[model samples]
Target: MSTEIIYQTLAILLGFAGLIWSADRFVASSASIAKNLGMSTMTIGLTIVSLGTSAPEVLVALSASLSDSGSLAMGNALGSNVANIALVLAITAIVAPIPIAKQLFKMEAPFLVGVTALLGLFIFNGELSRLEGLILLLLIPVFLWLVSRTQTGVEQEEIERSEGFKTFAWFIVSLAILIGSANTLVWGAKGVALTLGVSELLIGLTIVAVGTSLPELAASVASALKGHHDIALGNIIGSNIFNIIAVASIPGVVGPLAIDPDILSRDYYVMAGLTALLVIACALTLKRRGSKLGRSFGVVMLSSFCAYYYFLV
Candidate 1:
């Protein structure tokens, strides 16, 4: 490998590490600050924590948009959704079957499909306009509200409170690191894409997408192992919704983004198919009591993920 390629690869690796660490700290600091301000744990979770989990994708999209690589940003959004289901959720289910509450199937899962369909509509014209971006952004509050309603009367999570100055300092520092790391990852990804003669969209779809999705993978798998099936499935569904509405809007909001035809023709189909499969799996196993996505379904999901990657290459 060329020295330049090596440096770029290092940058990508380091960037991913920094992003994961800093994003975690940023969320912790934010939670601490919110708790200090007397915000309820559920409120902080539904809003700040939810957004925090997607911080890498949001920042990466922002950096890619500013650099005029909107296709990469779009790919990050779509590809992250694919990875969340086919890879992260798949692996989690393999570790432990994810149980689905009938309520989640009736509500959150359908909401994700709706959001995905909305994204498809916006990008169908071959571009995402600034107006469409604004529309997506405006829906965030609605999404949060809906999610808050679902969590009504749920147990409150215990949060740790830190000193005000320390919390603020960490928040600022982590935010700065998040931005810088996102830029570094974008630069490195673009460099690698150029070096390999591959499109930035593909790099975003594969490498950057998976890297940014590390948080979800970890959270979901850990939650599943601990028998928090709702959290595991909920994490994936929520992240995918956020990606469609929030992270995907960055490029369009920054400037009009011309989406590649392949996004709709190929990637979108893959994402949508997996999403439908998730709902179908739940419906097939749906019991009046609950639905379980068993090890068999997980194997199918993993196989589909491999097939999708093969198709991509």
Candidate 2:
């Protein structure tokens, strides 16, 4: 192989490795903190666990934004959301079909769709201004507060336990791993993009997107394997919500991102369609009284993703 091919291969391998390691670290640390804090399984599934799993995507977007790779930054955020639903969830279903979270459909999924639509609207102005970014950033705290307000008494105890020294320690460790792994993946992605003569947008959409989404994949798969339908479904729904509002929002604030109008017009619409498809699937599955995502559903989701990939190429 040529030198460029070798570098590209190495970059892709290292990126994948860093992502997997970071994901494992995130799961371990999050689970430990949640356990120590006496958090309920549902609360953990919705908040702390979801945030931990999304840390890699958040870090990657922030790093890319700071580096002035606006397209890659935004693409990672949007592409990861797309992948989380179509790719990650599909794989998890194939491993062990995951059930839909009814509450998630009523609450978080709508919020996710709203945020995604808002993002598309905001970027239609060509660039996400600093003021817009600030607005998006402010929304994150508000969202957390809203989620907290809806928590049950049992969930409250879990949040309370999340406040001690051990919890803080786990948070710190998870944050460190998140940052370190993000840096490694970004560097490797850049190297690979250069060597392969591919745009960073493509890299972010495919390689980087998949890498940052590893945590979600791991979390969903684990939940499915354990037959915790709510946890499995909640994690995917929450992560998808965060990827759009939280992850995509950061780039808008860190710096102005000039979104390709074409992306907004085309890809963004495709993303919305995919989100709708997921919602429809969830509704149909629930109607059928099926707790597990069936093989046919998994195949449809996977095939949709494959078609999207082909369009990208």
Candidate 3:
């Protein structure tokens, strides 16, 4: 490759690494700080923790948006949802079948579908106005209210466990790194796309998108292996909701976003289909501790993801 491309390649690699680590630290510290300030476990779980896991995506979207890469911003939001479900959860299920938390099918899963449908309807007009962006942002509180009701039994231990190795100073440092690296990630992605004559949507869908999704892959697989099925599936469902509603709106909030009809026609459809599949899988195996997702389901999900990636490529 050319010298500039090599440098950009390094930036993307380092950016991914920094983002994963720093986002982890940021989440931990932020949660710990809130806990120290006497915030209730359910409140922290529903708000800060959800925002923490999704921090990389929101930051990436903001970075891409401010950099005038609106397509990248939109692509990252849609692409991350696709990866979170089809790829991340698929691999998690393959490693260990994720059990169905009865509550998952009852609330969060359906809420996610509703939010995804809302996103679909917004883009149906072939554009998302600033007014639409504000509407999406306003819906976050409604989501939080829904989460609070469902998470009424959210345990203190779950919140503590999610916060790993908390460090207040390191949180600030990592927060800075996360912001800086997000810009780096976006710049490198745009550079590589330009050099290869690839569209920003393609670059965002393939490389940049997957890189940001690394956090979900790590968290979900770890949760599944540990038998914390709620955290495992909940992480994917919650993050996808956050990505669709919050992260996707940043481009328009920052500036005018040109709607890509391909998103409505293709990528978002892949997201919607996988989401419906998740709901069906949960409904079929509704037992709380049952293997709603076994190796067979894993194979199917993974196959679907592979086909999606193939289509993208």
| Reference-based TM-score of each model | 0.79, 0.83, 0.81
Model 3, span 162-206: residue lDDT tens: 333445676568667765675577678768877778888888787
lDDT of each: 0.77, 0.70, 0.74
Better of 2 and 3 by TM-score: 2
CA RMSD for every model?
4.0, 3.8, 3.8
Better of 1 and 2 by TM-score: 2
For candidate 1, give the lDDT. Answer: 0.77
TM-score of 3: 0.81
Comparing 2 and 3 on lDDT, the stronger one: 3
Runs with alpha carbons beyond 4 Å of true place in candidate 2: 1-38, 153-186
Model 3 residue pairs with clashes: none
Task: Return the TM-score for candidate 1, rounded to 2 decimals.
Answer: 0.79
- List the candidate 1 regions with Cα displacement exceeding 4 Å: 11-49, 155-190, 288-291
Error of 3 at 74 (Å): 1.4
